[model samples]
Target: MPAEKKAYPLRISPAVLEAMQRWADDDLRSVNAQIEYVLREALRKSGRLKPGQAAPVADDQDDST
Candidate 1:
C-alpha cells in the first residue's frame, strides 16, 4: 500500500503562487498536485531519485508542439 500524505505548511510569494495556479490550471491539475509534479521532476533531473524508486513520467511520442 502507498504511504499516507503528510501535510507541510509552505510559504510562497503571491506572484509565484499565482503563476503556479495558472500553470496548474493549464495542466488540468490542482495547484497542490502541480507543485508536487514540478518538484518530482526536478528531483529526477538532478539524479537524486533512485532508478525504479518511483514510477516513470510518461513521454508523449505524438506531441507535435
Candidate 2:
C-alpha cells in the first residue's frame, strides 16, 4: 500500500517554478512528484529521515548534476 498524501499550498517564485518544471520534465515526473522527490532526498541526506525510513524514489543520474 502507498502512503497517504496531504495537499498544501506552496508559493514559489516564477523562476524557481520554471526550473522545477524543466527538471521534472527531464525526470519524467509530475512537478509535484519531483518536488517531493527532491525534498525526500534532502531530508535523508541531512539525517532528518532515519535509515530504513521512507525512502525516496531511486535517482539513476550521476551525481555531477
- Top of the candidates by lDDT: 2
lDDT of 1 by residue, 1-65 (tens): 44345467889999999999899789867677777779888888899976666653332321211
lDDT of 2 by residue, 1-65 (tens): 45555667889899998999899889887677788788888888998987768755543432222
Clashing pairs in 2: none
Model 1: residues with Cα > 4 Å off, grouped in runs? 55-65
Error of model 1, residue 38, in angstroms: 0.3
Full-model lDDT, candidate 2: 0.73
TM-scores for every candidate against the unseen true structure: 0.74, 0.78
lDDT by candidate, in order shown:
0.69, 0.73
Best by TM-score: 2
